[model samples]
Target: MSNGDEEGVLRVLVVITRGERGGAQVHVRDLLVGLQGRAALHLAVGEEGFLADEARTIGVPVHPIPALQREVAPRRDAAATRALLALARRIRPHLVHTHSTKAGLLGRLVARRLHLPAIHTAHSWSFSDGISWRRKAFAIPLEAAAGRWTDRFIAVSAADREVGLRYRVADDARVVVVHNGVADTSLRARPDRPGVPVLVMVARLAAPKDPLLLLQALEQVRAPCRLRLVGDGPDRGAVEDAVARLGIEDRVELLGTRRDIDAILADAQVGVLVSRQEGFPLVVLEAMRAGLPVVASDVGGVSEAVEHERTGLLVPRGDGEALRAALERLSADPGLRAAMGRAGRSAYEARFTVQRMVEGTAEVYADVARRHGLPALRRPQTPGRP
Candidate 1:
């Protein structure tokens, strides 16, 4: 491992497969922001999208790896490995921290070749529950192979850590759970309104994230409620068609990709995320930070953040009737919504604050640096303290 900067600040090369706006992208962006000033950060990412834009805006050096794509192409994979190795050579980072599956595989390989410590944050394993059998078959062995090259694995949720062990991706001692976090938005209190309740679901209209399931459940909601779908993906057209076919177009609004999520949640009554799978979604924490009760599918570490009947309701994945009941119950009772929202906000402050996530990650970096014989990373100063 290269000795860090002269001042001893760890030079970390963060890698991720895509720069697209999604859970993994958001996690990377937030981690970069929180690590600012505490470390010398560089990003090697594929595609130019929100993650790249945000990293540049925050003044982190962003390296574009054209061959680093999500799909499995042997030629491109080989090229991406060469390009990443070259970049790692040039940057001479003390450690390489990778996110997502593709980057994790390639980044760790590069780190191993260079004899540098590698830390991989598994946003969600491809073989986790709710994924297709074919995908699981492909992923299990690949992850097990990559696990040997990884120095430490950071699973965003304990559930994800368990999956890693169950699949033999890593031993229990190597994987640690560091829950995702977001900036607090609790000050943007939900407004007290009298019109029909509005339920906001902020997830990409894509597979795994079943926006149509929420739409289907919304149709069964007896109470008059408007559903706002706040994301865009390949399934947008299908969701639009579902909104029309369900004949609830008038009750649903497709607000595709908005930056002002806190504002939107402030104006709404409840926040919802119905997905086939997840790995401690940041949006759930975002909702909790905004003091809005959440109704999410009970999958992949969501239960760690959302306490049933306290912070919000958790229904079985794909169960339209249960989903509808949860939505209806929250919609009809304003008092319950307000109470749950308060509890959610409290939970966010206690466990899901951005500071906690950043600190946890920094500690992991320090540990890896020490094990690799690198100098200790300077601790990040608390935001408000003198």
Candidate 2:
């Protein structure tokens, strides 16, 4: 704060490849907005995506790199790295901040090449979840190499930090855990109360999300209940097929990608997430904020969010039996569900607000600046920032 590095100019460039409506992208948007007036800020995201669109809407200078995409394309990825490096050269950023797996690797390497300090936030580990062993083989080693050059690694959950340390991706001294944060989304009255309780899951319909496991659990439910999936992705067709195969078509509704999530949550009695891997997910928080008890997989930072037999139940990854039992338990007991919902809301207010996320991340930024001897930190330009 008040030392050797207080008088120099410091600029931050936040980079991400996929800017679609995932947790990582949401984190970037919120971080930039929260960090407003704290430092000179810029964002480099995939060209013409939701992340860029929203960042621009919030008045951040956005540099779109077409080559920066989610799919692994060697030529396109190299081009994106070059684009980022060239942008870094022009901006002369004091620090390079990266999110997600691919951008962290490429951007951190670029930062090191230019002799600049770099900070990476592990939205989730690249090799995490249930990817093929072959993919994991290369990803783990490559990420370890990337971690070597990263000055500081911010883990979104304790689970992620452990993953890095376990893999020797980075030393414990260099890794810090900062739980993701959520804002108070506007609530709407839910009057569509079905006689049979409804379960809602808001996540992309992808393999990692494991929406299929949720369907299998529904088939095992003794009591009648309905499931509403509020998002869509590559696995949409498969998910639909599973619902048909399980003969739960009448009970399951696929309300593909929704903008009115709070409203949707307002209607549902319980929320579930069956992702095989995750960081601290924003969707879980959204469900908690809406006063809905969550039944989610106990992988990654999920245990950090939902307390077993407290706020909500945490099932083992891909365990349809455990998932079924938990869902049935919640659905059968309205009073217990309400109690869990109240507890979840209390937890959300206590530890998971956007204010905490912003201030915590600011401390990380200050830490980086101090360690780099870059500049004496300044009070935020704006008197009040949430």
lDDT per residue for candidate 2 within 1-386, as digits (tens), equals 11222235467889888877888888888888777656667888876777788877767788988898877889998999999989999877789999988888889989989988889998878776655678878889988888888889899999989888877888999898889988786673231244789899999988679898889889999987889999889999999899999898999999997778889998899989998889889989988888889999999999998999988999998888999999999888888888889888889999898878887888888988988887644575542322
Per-residue error for 25 in candidate 2, Å, reads: 0.6
Model 1, residue pairs in steric clash? none
RMSD of 2: 3.5
Error of 2 at 253 (Å): 1.6
The lDDT of model 1 is 0.88
Each candidate structure's TM-score, on Cα atoms with residue i matched to residue i, is 0.96, 0.93
- Candidate 2 TM-score versus the reference: 0.93
Candidate No. with top TM-score: 1
| Model 1 ranges with Cα > 4 A deviation | 1-8, 382-386
CA lDDT scores, all candidates in order: 0.88, 0.84
Against the correct fold, how does model 1 do in TM-score?
Answer: 0.96
Best by lDDT: 1
The residue ranges of model 2 lying beyond 4 angstroms of the native Cα positions read 1-9, 188-194, 376-386
